[model samples]
Target: MIPITMIPRSEVQKIEKPGWVLVFGRRKTGKTYMLRHMVRHENYFFVTRGGLILEHEEQLLYPVFEERIKNLLLKDITVVVDEFQRLPEKFLDLLHYHSPDSRAKLILVGSSFSVARKLMERRSPLLGIVRPVKVGLIRPVDLIRGLFKLGISPELLLRIAPYIRDPWIMRFVNPGKFRRSDVIEAIRFNVPALIGEVFSEEDRVLTDRYELIIRALSLGNSTPGEVAGYISGFIERGLRSQDVKSYLANLLRMGIASRTQLAGRKRYLYSIESPLIDLFYYLDTKLGYYEIDVPMEELENLASVKEGTYFERFVVDLIASLYGARVQRSLDPEIDGILVKKGRIVAAIEVKMGDIAREEIIKFLERAPKEGEKIVVAREGPSLEGVSLLTHRDILSMAMNFEQRF
Candidate 1:
């Protein structure tokens, strides 16, 4: 399996100090894989998930940890506790107590909501001492490079294949002899062809859930209520208490969908992650048609809105990931995106799917702090007053820029 953890593994090598480091990300995003890969040669213990060892008012889970510290006497030796949040709160105290003069490092990895709340919220033991590492999904670059490393042909890679959003589709298809049956089987099963290395249990669950969600999203149900109804109906024929919120939260954590709330109504639009899914939802399917297939022109028009929205979301995710630990995303009425660095608002972006007037741009720009940069992002060529206007192409280019910059 390809070790994508090499990126953080290289970064960890540069840290000589014996300080604590917390590696966190949504479940199935490869946090544990990175942690284990980084400390392979070092003395490390993999703690059981959702399990903890504790004593009265203290955590002795690391009972032999002190002994290992003296025995190793090495700067790079580290201990990793997978699913650290599943353990009781005392686990943090144990790590801190033994960290005074030892060269041993602590690597904590867990999923979203639980771990993020503990490490980032005020009054967290992990606060101020731990460095946060976030792992996102396989990027297009990573996919291309990973496939090449596996000796897959470039010609096969360039095929105008249906975007495979599901994992089960990889099971039956061979390298050559692609056919309509294969595509139908894939659509029926909802599995993608290529697997991002480092498959985990949580990853499988997410892949299945995303398959269901994308199907619902393809049926003209983009809003939370619509998606929720579809999923709830699909799962058990009825929606349970908090079923919508629970499934939506899980999908967001898995990077399958994203949420953005509109004005006056607290309702959010839960968009599918893949443009292929969007195309399947809008372009391929027709509603109550007179037995005629959608034409190229109709397909293109249907695709425009979904593609535009996907592009906007791509820009938001790019900025959020690249400038991570520096920026925060908010869905305010006027602002489509927000950037906060060092806990202060530094920039705001308004997303426009198509041509928009300068007056709307001004209203959106008003939401940003006067001291920070204000910009409008759109598909059409940009125009705005006193604010930087950037096109969809420019917005994507900015992601690479931030990748190189701070």
Candidate 2:
């Protein structure tokens, strides 16, 4: 297991008082990893869904409580329940029952939104007793800095860092500047050929062809029809509307795609978490489908297109890290970002991939009501009238480094 720090040790130190904490994040975001790391210093009781599930809720929970409080007569014991929502709802009362009497601490961790929603619903036993904390992707800088400390050569870091979306994964690889063909070759081997690995095997196929379709949409096919057409033509597979929607929905939840409506046209934006995925989707053919129609050379050439959407997703993730709760995506005129702090507009940003045009800047600015601060992000440094130009890197860095001003 690769250790990536999401919350600093100092932050955990501040939570000395006994209370309920609900830590959550998307799948594979290292929530349980950090929780286990934190509990090592204390006499902690770890309970999971599988351990507590039974037809009789109380019977399942009573044993857990008895075991947790067993032989601990010192300072308050900490109880960490991963996937707490999966436990019977009645278990919430059990948690509330022992805390005041034994002075024990409870930490509930859940990964699925469905679980979170059930726990947060009104009249739910866990409602109002939990403080929600969302864990997100590890920052690129933190991953890079940690890798350097771990004896990974910086020379390799700069080379492979840009390709990996998960900074923790990328910085660990620490290869040199990757050629498009080289990375695609890696994808051709890594993306599985079995549908079971990529999707539910009973229903899906692990066709690299589907991944290529997702890549095509991410690159620039914002509309559903257009994206569907691109995928069908590229793979020569007759695609359906439901297929597109289901696949896209999965991608959005994974933080790999985003969607919004503008003038009745729903635009789906790609959140490229891994540049390697991007390169694989764009360049590699052998990995996606059961069979290949495009020549290997042509596929490699296809991946060579300048990727702007990949950087856009990076910006979104960076901003999400900084302003997790304060940010909202705007629907009017398709602006890339809208930030509100303390009920006031703080910053509005839109990312343009290349060639900052004055008219385009004006069009984007018009989406905002001219409140607070506004900035435009682009690949090239351009001096535009009435607009501040920010490099893609600078914008991403600022989002990661943003501090709440309210």
Candidate 3:
């Protein structure tokens, strides 16, 4: 087994505080791992799908567990409940009842945001008592450091880093032994299983429409109007831009898609947030939905496109993550990435699959913020005046360097 390094998350400090913490994020973002690292074995309780049955260790049924916890002398004890959403409604009610006066700190780890929201809604018994901490994908810097520690070369790390953003997927990525087939199998089976559960259980009403919108966005239909146009072709009725907007809003809320706006531009561009979702959509389309077999040539073509797109997005997100920047999109010159900080443009970036030329750099610089930094990230690029040039290896090194400092 490859030993995994734990990335230092700021939220771990918050978990140490004395209050109810509702940890919310998508599955496999390390919610359980972080909790297990911080909370003692005796203090933690994991609620499985088998309901409240007590198993090995200190597992307990809700009724008996509730009585035991309530009767225990209040000390510095921290009670951690993993998959707290799976517990019965009464168990949550008990937590709500005890939250105000209970001496023990309660840490409830939930995989589904919708379920967590329901428990913490205004009318719910836990309202105003729980502090929400969202566990996002591990930072790029930390992920690079961990993979390097596991013997993955920087080159291989850059190659696979884009697709395996979720740490759960990293377990399957063995540097020398990994292959594209492994990625396809992982996406084919895991993406639907994880994302499907969230949509079916939480957003069941418009799940079909949600999938359609995400598919459209994954296919490069970035604008709201473009996505609406693409989706309208299949549905019975013509989709109004407003209706499409509403669906996009829902996607954003569920963390499936993200919206970006240019610095001074009002138009918003939508993109699928999860790399797994993007890969699934790409392969699903290339293989012809519901079809089992995919031609090798077509698969290669899809992989090429996936690599290009993922690399561009990775570079943009890496820069944003490093500098605490907000990514934006602009038309008319079609800049690839815009970084903003404190409402001011800090950098303009262009990501390319091939080498960038002097003229191309000059063109991008012309459209970029005059006083801000201009960057061109490509597979191969010659040095140009008045621009920062970065290759994929350079990016990996930059992220690794940041991790060392952290």
Candidate 4:
């Protein structure tokens, strides 16, 4: 087995201080893994699907668990409750009441954004007492480092990184050993389990509509009108743009999807937040619900086409994150990514899966702000006058350099 280091997250440092800390992220973003690394195993309480685990072996009942927490806090121990959302609101109230007097620091970790939002609502017991920290996707530099440690080639890593963005998935992947059959196997074995765990609670309230919206968005129907129009074709009832907008809003709140708007444009484009989730939807669409057995070659062909677009989006988002930039879609010249910083256009970026021509680079540069940088990110690209050309290797190096500074 390859050794991997816990990429020191900034939030972990905050946990050392006193008071209540609420750490949240979608499942497998490394919330529990990071917390377990930072705190002692005995100090951590892992909440399984069955419910809360107390004192390693014993399962503590609800109200009784509250008393146990109070007693733990009185002892001035740093307590970590993983998936704290599984507990009742009364448990939170208990923690809130005891927090001020006790020396113990409370760290509550949750995977579901909806649950976290409800817990931190204006009327909820955890509203004022807790500090929220989101555990998102791993940094590009850290991801690169981990893959390198696993003996994955730079070229292969770039090709596969887009599909397996989550560290939880990436850690298990071996590029050297990967085959076309592995894609189908992963989708067949892994995707269902992840969907079941993450969306089971959501399914209770959302029904099939949520899956329909996801399918629509994954198919490139980004606007509210486009989503409603596409979804209308499938469902029996008439669906309005407003209904799609409301569903998109719920997705945004749930941290499953995000909305992007251009600097001057009024229209917003909606897309799923997690690349892994997007890949899942893409595969689902290709294979369909009833198809039990798909040929490996067919799955490979479909994945190749979908992964090209995924790679571009991954590159754009990684660049944006590095520069602390907001992504904007430009209309006139049709730039792939507009990087804005402090309300000014810092860079205009064009992402291509293959090598970009000199003329194409010049055209993009002409549309970009004169004072701002113009960049073209591709697999292989030639140098152009006044334009920054970055290859997959160059991007990884940039991220590595940035990680060193951090």
**Candidate that would win on lDDT:** 3
Which lDDT tens digits does candidate 3 get at residues 147-263? 666565555666676765666676665656667766766677777777776675464554667778888887888878898898888888867788889888777767678778855
- lDDT tens digits by residue: candidate 2, 1-406: 2345532322243333446677765555556666777554344444544665332234346455545444342246676666665555566776555445555566777665445666688976778777766654555544444434444333343334345434334323324333445555545645433213325312245466557556765466655566677777666666776677777776654444555433223444443445655455545333442245456676655664634445454454445445542445565556667666666666677776655777777777778657756777776655666666877556534643554331
Q: How well is each residue in 1-406 modelled by candidate 1, as lDDT tens digits?
A: 2235322322334332346666655444445555555554354445555353332244444545444445553465665656666555675765555556656576666655446656776887667777766554434323333334434333343231123212223345543454333433343213232221112423444354455566677665756567667677656566543556676676665555666544334566666654444555444344311134435455445444554455455455445555552334455444566666665666676766666677777677666657567867665544755788876456445543443321
lDDT of candidate 1 vs native?
0.51
lDDT, candidates in the order shown: 0.51, 0.54, 0.73, 0.72
Ranking by TM-score: 4, 3, 2, 1
What candidate 4 gets wrong by more than 4 Å, as runs, is: 1-18, 38-42, 49-52, 62-64, 202-206, 369-371, 403-406
CA RMSD of all predictions: 10.0, 7.4, 2.9, 2.8
Greater-TM-score candidate between 3 and 4: 4
List the candidates' TM-scores in order.
Answer: 0.48, 0.59, 0.88, 0.89
Residue 6 accuracy (lDDT) in model 1:
21
- Greater lDDT among 1 and 3 belongs to 3
Q: Which ten residues in a row have the lowest lDDT in candidate 4?
A: 1-10
lDDT comparison, 2 vs 4, better candidate: 4
Q: Which of candidates 1 and 4 is the stronger one according to lDDT?
A: 4
Best by TM-score: 4
